[model samples]
Target: MTDLHFECTGARPEPFGASPTLLFGLRIEESDHQPVHAIALRCQIRIEPVRRQYEPEEVGMLGDLFGEPSRWSSTLKPMQFAHSSITVPGFTGTTDIDLPVPCTYDTEVASASYFRALSRGEIPLLFLFSGTVFTGRNGFRAEPIPWHKESSYLMPVDVWQQMIEEYFPNSGWLRLRKDCLESLRRYRSQRALSSWEQVFQELLATAGAKGGD
Candidate 1:
């Protein structure tokens, strides 16, 4: 595994399924490296229906695209793990990278609800989009978690844009924030998102954690 930097503001630990073993799901990467490939981001939000508990997803994107989503079964459980591609232009291959997540604390209720459950040990966290598991080339193609969205598994551009602003917003942060924002803006509808640029600036001022650069 590549050595990654992560941090947790309001995170702890919990248990997984079946075996119900304790698992930790907090932002673990704190680095200044730019993601090599994809312009998109993904996060693994831990949820527990039993106690109505959940955990905040990590907030950032890692390296570039390599291949397609390869589905495989967990050696211990029926739960499926989807391993995506991995490819960075000159970076050989990153053995370690964290998933990208947004500051849900200041945004929608889904995020709030998840955080609330996190403190209760009702769920365990995972980095679904980190280079540790999934990957992409040029840009990562996101599949919507059926549990997160009903229509398309791909994260709608607006949500992705907000996430970008939250984690890596500086011009030096990534060479493609402008492109990502522009793409999301193209998909913005009257009811979707109206102000990504403004949101980016606002989140930078508010979600003051010093990682995911």
Candidate 2:
């Protein structure tokens, strides 16, 4: 059996990734100073929303996900952010690896919406780790990594913002049904709307006028 420890030192935005991605610094340590042949590490990252305080504006934005602020006591629960895996090469004592976590800008996703709602402060994250550990002095022996292997890290909100900005500058993603998209397209064609922004603006103005009536 091997005793393994995990820690998330920091995180940063992946500049050259094809999509919005975050790289979390993962440090793994072997307690007994044993030579680890290899490791197939799988991690489940979760956002612990109850661990941090929310601003008034943030609370308002998060209403759709967590409901009213007063109901947050019960509604605020951990949300899954990403599930990622990495192959760790053999090491004797310890090793550091980059955990690549692919992210999406779709506002329909709970994690993305929660992240967008945040203005500042760190996001409390819980990393649950599991996988196979290959180790032995004479030869390689396969063993299961304990389920209790977990770590907690406070990721700065700015990092996420930076990643989003890099991938989508001054823009946001909204997923709509096929029928709704067709309807929007027809509306845009009929009105000769040059851009989606203009279409949305026109619709909002019309809605406001109707509301005042």
Candidate 3:
């Protein structure tokens, strides 16, 4: 059996990807210095929210997801970020690979909301690894990678911000129900609103007036 170790060296935004993507640099090593036929690797990435501190503004933004700060001890749990897989070609002793993690700007997602709330500092991440390892000295052999295999990484917040900015510059995404969308469209048409932003601005002004009264 090959004793394998995994490490996340760093991460960066994928410039040419069709969608928003993050490439994590992964390093894998074999203890016995044997020839590996290939590895079918599956990774589950999680965000450990409890591992980092939050700002006052961030807390306000996170209220919908985790509730109030007073109740955070129970609410602030690990959130699933992504599940990704890669097939590493045969290598001797050690090798490096990029794990492409597809990302979304949809703020309705818990992970995306949490990420957007952060102002600064690293996001604590836990990577759980599993899959099959094909290796042998003489011929092809297969072994199950242990379930206990895991790694931790502190991904810089700026990296995520940069990626989002590159794709959505000065904009954010929101998901609404079909009925609500149709209503907004009707409202916009009735008012002859040239853009969605204008429609939202008018609605907010109306809401503010109603609140004041």
Candidate 4:
């Protein structure tokens, strides 16, 4: 019967990951100073919408995810951000480890949309922890971590934006339906467009000229 305390000290962008990632500094302390062998940790991270205020522009950008500002009282709720698992090495009383969380820029996801909408400030995040904890003199005991173990952290929005910029670099991504993509490909091929940007610009110009007439 050991009680564990979790705290997130800070976060930073991972340098050499395949996808964009943020590594959070996690400190875990056990109530009883027993020799723990390891922890098979699983954490559910949530974005708490009501924990922070939003700018007018942010609210406008986030309307698609949470609806209008007027309706936020009902709509403002925790959003599932990510789920990550790690094997925390054993310690006597306390230990610090890196909690790596994979991130995406897919606007279709509510968490990603919410993150993109924010210009500045901290993101209120809740980490719910569960799994098996191994302990004892020779790693003899195994027990289940309590369900109520949770921790809150305010992650700087700038950190997330910076990480995204590092990977995307002044660009955005979108996933199109196969049929729509095929149609766009055909359009591009018909005009011998060199790039998708050009194809889109040509379409916009054609639409504008038609509207002018």
Query: What lDDT, from 0 to 1, does candidate 1 have?
Result: 0.31
Candidate 2 residue pairs that clash: none
Q: For residues 48-121, could you state the per-residue lDDT of candidate 3 as single tens digits?
A: 99999888988999998999899999999899999999999999998999999999989889999889999999
**Poorest stretch of ten by lDDT in candidate 4:** 134-143
Q: Give per-residue lDDT, candidate 2, residue 58.
A: 89
lDDT of each: 0.31, 0.95, 0.95, 0.93
Write out the backbone clash pairs for model 3: none
User: Candidate 1, which ten residues in sequence have the lowest lDDT sum?
Assistant: 59-68
Clashes of 2: 0
Candidate 4 lDDT over residue span 1-213, tens digit each: 988999999999998999999999999999889888999999999999899988888888988987878899999989999999999998989999999999999988889989999999999999999999999875489999999999999999999999998999999888889999999999999999999999999999999999999
Give the alpha carbon lDDT tens digit for every residue of 2-96 in model 2: 99999999999999999999999999999999999999999999999999998888888999999878898999999999999999999999999
Order of the predicted models by lDDT, top scorer first? 2, 3, 4, 1
The local distance difference test score of model 4 is 0.93
Backbone clash count for every predicted candidate, in the order shown: 25, 0, 0, 0
Clashing pairs in 4: none
Estimate the TM-score of every prediction. 0.23, 0.98, 0.97, 0.93
- Can you tell me which runs of candidate 4 are displaced by over 4 Å? 204-213
TM-score (C-alpha, index-matched) for candidate 4: 0.93
